[model samples]
Structures are given as structure tokens and as C-alpha cells.
Target: MQTPLQFCPRCKKDVAFVAAAGARTCPECGFQYAVSEPPNPGSFPDRPDRAGNPWLQFLTIAGIVVLALLGAGALLLGILFVGCALAFRG
Candidate 1:
């Protein structure tokens, strides 16, 4: 079921509604018209699903913290081991 075309305000030409566009230009006179939906009492278009998952958010933060701590610990251990080796050699 296709929606009806809207009339161009400038030239009164019929302009079809584009799904992703807000306004369309008239083919006849190049006049722009705002796309409007037909009045339906109980019509709901497909809406984007909410990206709401509590566990996913918690796991992402935990993973970042673990990686940061591991990286810092590894760096500190490397520095300490190298310093101890150099001191013993001297």
C-alpha cells in the first residue's frame, strides 16, 4: 500500500513521499514539498530497538579495567626485573 503524493506548495504539483527524505522537489517546476504521512489512528512504523543490556555494559567496563591493570602490572614487573638484573651485573 503506497501513500498518496503531497502537493508542492510553490507550484501545486504532486510530489511522492520518500521514506528517508523529509522533502522532495516537484518534477514539473522543481518546487519543494514537505512529505506528510496519511492519518492512521493505529499505525506504528518499525522503530529501532533499544540497545539496553545491563550485563553487556558491566562486562565492557570490567574488561577495560582488567586490561589496564594487567598492562600496568606487566610494565612495572618488566622495569623491576631489568633494574634488578642491571644492579646484580654491576
Candidate 2:
């Protein structure tokens, strides 16, 4: 089903509600809007599930931390390898 269009307060333009719900960004003015109850009831033809899951949020943070640590470790190892090569050459 297609979602109805909504009016953007900043741009005074009719923007697609489905696109705004997914991105929370206004197509015209680039203004950001929160995905919550519409200011006027029935403004949005349909509501998309915007529920947050705690486990997913935790895993996302954990994944980012793991990636950062791995990147740092790789950088340190690269520096050490270069230093060892230069020292042995001297």
C-alpha cells in the first residue's frame, strides 16, 4: 500500500510520507522530522513499524567497538613492522 503525502512545514511542499518515515528527512528543505505520532491525526495514511529492539541496539554498538579495536590493532602492527624493517636496515 502506498503512503499518503504530507506537508513539510519548512518547505511548504507536499512530501512523500513513506520516504520521510524511512529517512526522517524532508525531501524539499532537508529538514529532519521525528517519526512519532503525526501532529494531526490521520495525517499519515499508514504507520510503519518504528519499534526499537534492545538486543539489536546492543549488538550494533558491540560490532562497532569490535571493528574499531581491530582497526587500531592493525595500525599498531603496521607501524611496528615498518619500524623493525628500518632498524634492521641500519
Top candidate when judged by lDDT against the true structure? 2
lDDT of 2 by residue, 11-49 (tens): 888987435433567766787768654444545544444
Prediction 1 global C-alpha lDDT: 0.66
Candidate 2 error regions (>4 Å): 1-50
Q: For each candidate, give its TM-score against the true structure.
A: 0.45, 0.46
* Residues 1-90 of candidate 1: C-alpha lDDT, one tens digit per residue: 464577767766676634435555666677654546443346534431223456877998999999999999999999999999999999
User: Which parts of model 1 are misplaced by more than 4 Å?
Assistant: 1-50
List per-candidate RMSD values in Å. Answer: 11.9, 11.1
> In model 1, what is the error at residue 22, expressed in angstroms?
20
Error of 2 at 52 (Å): 2.6
